[model samples]
Target: MNLLKKRWLLLTAACVINLCAGSIYAWSVFAPPLAERLSLITGTAVTAGSLAAAFSLANGIAPIPMILGGWINDRFGPRAIIPAGGIVMGLGFYLAATAVTPLELILGYGLGFGLGLGLVYGSSVNTTLKFFPDHRGLAGGIATAVYGLSSVILPPVAHALIETEGIEAALLTLGGVFAIVIVAGGLLLEKCPDAFAKQFTAAAPGKQMAAEECDWRGMLRSTRFPPMVALMLCGAIPGMMIISHCWSLAKDVVGLDAAAASAMVSMLALANVFGRLLVGALSDKFGRLASLSGALILTILATVLLSLSDQNAHLLFSAGILAIGLSFGAFMGIYPGFTAEEFGAKNNSVNYGIMFSGFSVAGFAGPMAMNMLKEAGMSYQTICLLAGTLAILGLGFAYLFVRAKKAAYS
Candidate 1:
């Protein structure tokens, strides 16, 4: 009863942090205001706020905190880290509501808010993965998938809050939301008991060891780690292109109406959530290596089809969403399971952070490079084709990794 109670609490907290991260997927909602703030008026084809730039930067650069957060959790445990992360993150939102200038908003949302996110998100997968190692893939996927849904819900709610209550009130309201998530969930998030671990990981067992187990530098230098990180980077590389350009591509090439274009984005997120849960569960049954490799192959096909989707009705829409969602959710689904399987749970929190930077690298490059490439006369289709090529290459890497792992174990 006591351990179950603790898990309920911590899972609640993990869900909260995951939701905040997913809320980033709602960057489109803020683009208009941010654009206006940055002198990129809505009427202008390109907005000045560079919403994509700021969002990607904040999300990418922000992963730094995950390293520290994971380290803290490993040393002292989630009890100290999560609540502290929540308190700090809550304050960032309180300040964000008051932001007026572009620089101010960047600091508020980009740096400060980003920091809070980094702190909480750092531990989300690590903590939850420990709780349900049998379901690490599922557990981590569901935690991240909440953010997918967060994008769905927060945008409309945020709009309502901003319209009725005003931006300041909206900020304050969201701060409260973050506070609820942090406190309610934070209090809930505690270390899993050995019994819980036993029940969860009956088949794929875990070891109870010191909080500090792996050296990040040592992990970095190891041959085993880099391939996994590279696989993630390859899987994630084209995500920015799809999300940032989905609407424009739909309108410009596919000739979809505005309503259709909007629906497509929503469906994409919905598919992503589905992929996360389904893939994660399958990984638990099959193996992380198998599940992730299949996802990569699927992603490669979808990206290629999406690139040339000039007027395939919903095909472009369907393909693009599936690809983005798979790639987006795959990391969350795969990383925790992979790390736990390979490194032992004791070191998972810290080592995963170092590996997680592959995501940050994708975040930084995906948006800017996609846009820059398109502007430089590269067709979105052609670029997507290139992404497909990379995806195939990623699948090859995954194959090598799996083969090598088998050789080692056998």
Candidate 2:
């Protein structure tokens, strides 16, 4: 087959593999059952709060392996790294299934699964970007949208499995499936051909061409890097805050019952998927920074709406959640292509992994800020207002990023 057809096939394979890898988001489904099982095994009360550390560790430690995986992908191609990561991820699930204590669960799911997720996720995204230099935004959008959507798709299935087969069987069954699918996808992937970029220019018809190649170190040294990180952090904070607490927020602030709150979570996830696709395509036509700036503006509006929402304003609450979801998804969709455009695709695997540190920071900070403010006797409205203020600051950082990009690139 021709290169065009082959690349498209690889893209399909990447998406399928990412679907399995994205099962990390299904942790919410797993957490409760897993906690009950562990409680039974250890003869102690294992609450979800007790497992929060493991969840935090899982996310916090991923960047380390992601950086290593990206380096390997850049040097050795994705085939080996993808399969290896998949195996490790599966092993994590298997180990978690048999865990007798909280520490074991942390070791199994937290360190093991988190590390493998970083590897597979980073490799899949970077490989997809490498093949689609001419359509980076769209390709990135599709890849990440699938990843984000996995939560919606997997939760119901996982719940059913947990109900029918029990937690251990459910975990084992899912792990085996993830391993087999990822390995199959890995076999189909190949390195991007050297001539591919030359055959199709690095930009879409009206978009600016990509910058010259820069390794991770060079990218870090660039004047644009700091503001770029700040921009990502700013965009991610409110998104993470809302995402981490959406169900609770729906119940507490909007006065929804359990069922209605669950529906709101699904709505936010759908909006996230749509945002990724919409903004990603728009970035191709308009520009990455412009798209990101627009998203930030949406963030500001969303948070403001959220601040004003009360028990009587369910409609406003829903709208706020939808807008935040879209803006967050836009940020997630735009960054991979944005990083490639600014730094060059050659080192994108490592470079984008580094750029993702901003996200990791936001992940920790957003939730911590929310919890802290709540503990300080602040109302939900006060917290929402604070998030809106942060969005405004994010816009300032976006301007700085734009100026830095011009000064560095021009």
Candidate 3:
């Protein structure tokens, strides 16, 4: 049909491809089983805690490949880059299936899978943002919401597969499926036309203003970049901290049982998905900065609620968890469109990838801070209060970001 019709098809493909690539979030399902298999094979004690370094590597190394993938996607279009990424991801799983040592697992799943994930994830998001300039927030929200939802949806299926087929066979099966879906989806995508925005403007008389194009180098040099990164980091820290330790918080601090603690995890994931969808649409109408400010407020309030919550106050604890999930999801949803709006979409793939480095930093800092403080005999209440203080500082940074954006763009 027409190019317009083709874009919708491409959007569908991107969603499907993202669904597969997002399975990386379900790494928790594989961790214990994989660790056990490694222990048996290597005749050494391989705890899940020991295997966590590989998981950390998988997340920590993604930004490097994302930048590289974004560069390729910007130049050559997503069609080739996406399939290539899928192939590498599949190869990683294949290698992981044969791993006899922790190093091999790290190389295969950590480095290899992480590299492929960065490529595919960046391509899908960039492509979606390019095609839907008129609906960037909603488009990005849907893309990331599905990505976040993978952890919720895949865990049960992955657990079942591991139980029946064994970890190696399950890895092989899932890897093959992920590759086929991503490759097929990639084939359906095409680059956005140069005049696409002009066409939208012509069709809709009162649409948002056309974005000002800025290359990656110019974007990095801009006055707005630093504050924007700082705002993102601040917004992300509480979410990362809560997500990494929610189960422990639920169990040890809130005194939740096994089933209830598991439910808290599911609730957080669901809230995350809802937040991505809701804040994304709302930001389109309410403005990104305002929506972000609201999210930060919610984060601060959540932290306070959590700090005050105890075993006798399950409702308060649940509310705190829900709020953190929503606020965190809002940050994830807002940033893609916000980056494009601030720096422009022409170089968005690379620019957003660079912007995402803030998230990587938050990922490490949030969890490490929580773990260290807890190890040093700090109370959960004290930790939550500290997180709240960080959110307050983030709110200040958000104001700085707004000011910087206006000064630069105006």
Candidate 4:
């Protein structure tokens, strides 16, 4: 195939792999069911928070494997590692299906799923970035957008499986299908050609790129890195919180039934997908910092509105979902491109892996905070208010980064 065709194929394959890998996001659907099942089997009450630990722990554990996957992919191609990720992910779901204890659930879903996710996610995203250097934001967005889209497509099926066949069957079925699809995509995946890789070094006229061929260590040494990490952490917490706990919130706060809760999850995913695509394209047209600033501002507003919504105010709640989801997806869409712009695309796999550790931290911290605060007698609105505050904190970092960008380009 020609270069353009090959790149497009690779992008398509990456998207497919990500779609399968992102089954982890459907944890909201599984959390209540899994908790109920465990409670029934063990004859003890189980909290969604306890089960959510698996999800939080999964995100926490992912950073180590993410760094490993990136380093390996930097040296070797993605074919082997990506396929291995699929196998590992399948094994995780299989384990979850048979799990009767909380520990087993944690090991299966937390370590197994998290490790597999880390392995595949960075490789897929970096591969796309390498392929479309000129449109890094759009390319990265397209890849991650599919990951977000998984939430849109999978929750209803998962809900149906849990309702009809039970959670075990749901886990087993999803696992099997994901493994096959991811493996196929991994096999079909390709790195950018040498010609395309070379073009990445060539910048548009009068556009001064700050970082060029900068290694991870050098990138870390720069002042910009710290603020970026802070921005990512703060920006991600609210979204991760919502994603991990949305079902519970819908049931408890919105007083929605199972079907409605499932619908809420789908709505969140739809908004997320829209944001991913829109934010990436907007960043390409505008600037990454500008796009991030706008998203963060939106997050702050949406979070407050969500906090204020009562059970009767479903429309207000849905609006909050859409707004928060949009900001969440926007962050994911823009950050890969931002990493490449600031750190340098030459070492992007490793650099982004390191930068992504912030997200990993946020992912875990968000869920942990929610569950912990809930246990401590915090209201849902109180938690959301905290989340909104964090978004405000993120905006501060966004401003700093924008200033830094101006100084670099000036």
Specify the highest-TM-score model's number: 2
lDDT, candidate 4, 133-204, per-residue tens: 777778888988999898777777789989999989999999999999888888888755545655444354
Q: Candidate 3 at residue 288, lDDT?
A: 79
In model 2, the worst 10-residue window by lDDT is 200-209
Residue 328, candidate 2: C-alpha displacement in angstroms? 0.1
TM-score of each: 0.88, 0.97, 0.96, 0.86
> Which ten-residue region of model 4 has the weakest summed lDDT?
201-210
The lDDT leader among the candidates is 2
Q: What are the per-model C-alpha RMSD values against the true structure?
A: 3.8, 1.4, 1.9, 3.4
- Summing lDDT over every window of 10 consecutive residues in candidate 1, give the lowest-scoring window: 204-213
lDDT of each: 0.70, 0.88, 0.86, 0.84
Candidate 1 lDDT tens digits, 128-163: 877765567777677766766787888887777767
Instruction: Give the residue spans of candidate 3 off by over 4 A.
Output: 202-207
Quality of model 4 by C-alpha lDDT: 0.84
> Where does candidate 4 stray beyond 4 Å?
28-51, 159-170, 200-210, 241-262, 307-315, 368-386, 403-410
Q: How does candidate 1 score on lDDT?
A: 0.70
- Model 4 residue 155 CA deviation (Å) reads 2.7
